[model samples]
Target: MTRRLLALSILLCPLLAACSLEPLINHQVVDYFEANDIASNQVILQNILRAKDGAPLHFSELASIRGSLSNGASVSTTFPFMAPDHATTLPRKLGTVGMTITSSPSFDIDSLDTQDFTNGVMRPITPETAQFFLNEGIDYRMVLLLLVSGLRSGGRPEMLLNAPNSSRVVCYHELPALNALPTQYSILEADEPCDGQSEPEFYAFLRTINHLGRLYPLSVPQPPKPVGRPFDLDMTKALTAVASIDPGRYSLARLASGQYQLMSAAHGSYVILCRETPDGPAVAGVLTSERDESTPVPVDACSRKHGNAADQHASGDPAGAAQPMMMIGEQKNTVVFKLRSTLEVIQYVGQILALQQDETEANPQLPERCVTLEYENYKGGNMTCNFGVLFHLQRAGPAFSSPLNAVSYNGVSWSLPAPKVCRAPTRCDHTLETISVISLLLNQNKSSKDIAKTQAVQVVP
Candidate 1:
């Protein structure tokens, strides 16, 4: 019996040793295989999440991937795996973790109660609040999620749940599910993947507004006007001023009945004939010519000629022909003056006709005035003069007859109009009018429905 037991023990010892050795060898092999696989895949995953320079992938790129996965959009990508000594190889397949992105129901921002939020414990979501969350190391994506949730949930205030104990915050969308369970749903990190069963969906609405606010942190939405329709224009109380004159440089002067002159440099003068209207003042007519008097010759030449003739007349002449000569000279001067004055009137008329013909179409608001002057000298000397329109003025004030002043050529004296006051009780603000004009122009290109939709979606801070 002792000999039989010893023989059995000897057989059992070999079997036990074989069992232990087999398990040890298998574990070492499995560990080595897993370590190599992880090393290769780590490079691929890092490349997918970040660029070679370490910057995180852009949202658009990530969105494109998400869209392709959801919509089955054809996507082909190659990830290079780096090996020792700059050797590279492509990864056959990458393992994917389960992720689900679902859309939540739409809600109106206006319906939110902005005054009472978070049971009056915390303030509503604002730029300041958003910044506070960012400073606390909250990712922009999570911050946006909270803000959008608050905006959708009637401006409810958001708080960090289990913050002191755990750095996680409860998502409003998961509140209904969390309430039913003993455990609370919380976000552990900004980039924490959504667990389809536990976390389910991520709220993604108002994406454009969220992106704009987050990326351009300095930009804030402006509050809409308290009263008055956008781009409203009341022509009755609209500000009016002479169009052709620059209010900054020239002053308006009432030269005659129904005729107003902008006193500036003689070359820079503007003439406007205004008629009182229910809409302030309307320009009845505009003066197209400069106030100028022409002599037979240049003014200096005429003066010199007159002085010479006077001196000759005063000098004693033996023949009485000197008197006839003086008389002839006087006649010549009179004829030259008459001719010059007639030519000036003709030139003025021609300028008005040219302006009416749209010769200055190149510049619509301020047209170029072309004037030609022909001076005929009785002494067989003639000259031609050409000039362009000078004054370029923009409207300045609400009152049409407001005192507009202009600098003289000497820059010392100013041409001023009679004291005129605006009797209209209400006048359009120039700044507001400008904005209205631009808004009107932009709205003209959009349909009424489109305009309404845009206004509804506009976010005002």
Candidate 2:
């Protein structure tokens, strides 16, 4: 009886170990990335198993990896989940433990172009290609996953997968070595800018990858803020207004996660503010640098162009240079002049003191319209700077009933709301006068060193 019991116990030990994942890990590629995070565990496992490793394997490695996780804490960093509606408490789960197995047939890779292969479905895995990965003990699933991931996300496989390039895989690899990428696989493709529309497919793809990486993915917010939206500049009586805050820093793709700081400024202008944020792998923002305008402006003189005043053409004729204002009041105040001379200049100035006066005396809801001033050189080097006042008349309320006051121009407070508007110019005209208003308010006495320090926004190393 004692011998019989001992035999039964010994038999069960092998079965239990076989049912677990501990033994096969080192023999498989998933272990390498598991040695990397929890969310990626399943993806890594699937990809490794599907790669070129030539062998039939057991199922124990999968279960063992899953069992090893301690509430989202694998061998990697701890995932701390925040609780909802509460600040001090913690959530039950900090990270996700995926139930899907990499070897599971349900996994679908849509990015691969299989129609070109011999069977018209799946490509044959040759021993030569398999040998490279097999030597590293990578499975077919992992091999295919890596290939697909690389292809979809602008990797080497993308080139070969494209037409005309499909016939030359070896030749592609023969090119020069690049930053850890084969020259064939490392071309950086440009992406089209978002056109303020919903991008469901892209959003899903990114989310899937993030989930594979074990990260909590966030969707882009609506009305995607421009990377470098300019502030309104009204310089009538006295300039007074709050500068817009920086749109957070964006992390470029291919970099690891961490805080990245950047500076924002007017394009081809000056950097007026500095902002810092943790840029993720896909966000983009402005650097505190100026773009060269030595090249001619790209807009054709024939097509009417539009944007802020800074983008205006060199032509100074008011009729040819006139651009539609963003608001009715701004349009009403705008004055255009036909150029008779060689130069044309338009300047917008406003003050906060007038706004305060108007708010106190008249209608409080309506602020003064932007001040429009234009100057043109006709003949004999003659130039005149004309000015006008704009008033909004829509307010009929009892609490506010005065005409719009002049804006305060002194730099007393940077927090005031001093909004201004200017339409960008279009077309090239040799006879058109040019608008060139130097910002007198800009600190001209500042040393070049000081200006450089402000623009670069870098710590002296």
Candidate 3:
């Protein structure tokens, strides 16, 4: 009797488990083969599935193997391996069909919680307003379904009412399944009427919106850098006016009105380096080669012309212009946190002199300082601030290019020792903006292999 019961149990197991076959089949259908070997398996699975459960067969499988091609479509095989064949189901081109979808930049599509639709005003979900998803063109049926979903949530009634007429609606007579399934659906055509715009025009607007949204998501916000307090130093009383300037720098931030205010004070640079922290600023150490004061810079007509003009321009100004074509001295000062780690270096000796020539042309009253802050490396608990460096030229000068000195972070003020003078500081002027990019190859702790392979070479006479 026990042996007979064991045989019955074994026989009934497959029958009892057949009710939950989808999960079992799903697991069993997967084959661990190389990517190149998937085509034959796909064809085999298509046949097996069709025979087992009357599933629809995709055109590509039916065409070569079964000699059953789509009636109105042409198939073009680009590769031996797996590739999707494109097909059109339109019976006749009625003028031109067009559609589009759009969304607000502040709206989060993935997490469409109650808050997103809480406002009384329903944001348009048309192609003109869609910005969340990456794809620009969605099927007309998909557009209608999404609008229906929005309406079901009591979000936008108007959007649902005009779903058929949306600019990006794509009309299709018949739609096939994704993986050779027999499922079919129809798309709303673009000939439908909108209140003011034609179907094609509406579609073009939606297409533009979709393009903008893909390039710039609606939900993501512009990253705001940490705010650094304004610099306050008694430059007139405590600091000596005759002190030598080791490193030349500046920073700027935009106000609500879209105008950038500059901060030129040393304390501003310090605050930018140590944003929000009680500690003032990080020490920046200047890297320079040993040199005496007697070492003279090269003399050229180009450097002399603009270099002299820069000094003349700075005669009455608070901070003087950099000498033209001259290599400036280097110093190491601590940079605790200046906003972003990278600084942008512009190749504009000419633009600088032009700006000096017409200060009014480029905002006459430029701020002497600016600050930027950035958060980076956000993997759970690991985060760091990236300080940006921006440089603007005081005036246009000669086209002389050479390597500038390097700096590091020390405990005290930017420790810039052995300040190397340029050939002409006035002719080759520069100022740092709020967004500066720095080179990491010069980092002290980088690997030797990295230094040897990707390091930048310094240019010095």
| TM-score of model 2 vs. true structure | 0.14
Report the error of model 1 at residue 429, Å: 56
lDDT of 3 at 277: 17
Error of 2 at 76 (Å): 65
Of the candidates numbered 1 and 3, which has the greater lDDT value? 1
**Residue lDDT tens for model 1, 38-63:** 33222222222232223432111100
Candidate 1 vs. true structure, TM-score: 0.14
After superposition on all CA atoms, what RMSD does each candidate show versus the true structure? 41.4, 36.4, 35.1
Per-residue lDDT value at 446 in model 2: 23
lDDT by residue (202-246, candidate 3, tens digit) is: 232222222211121111111122234423344467345324423
Model 3 / residue 348 / CA error / Å: 50
Per-model lDDT: 0.26, 0.23, 0.23
Candidate 2's C-alpha runs over 4 A off are 1-149, 152-170, 173-180, 184-461
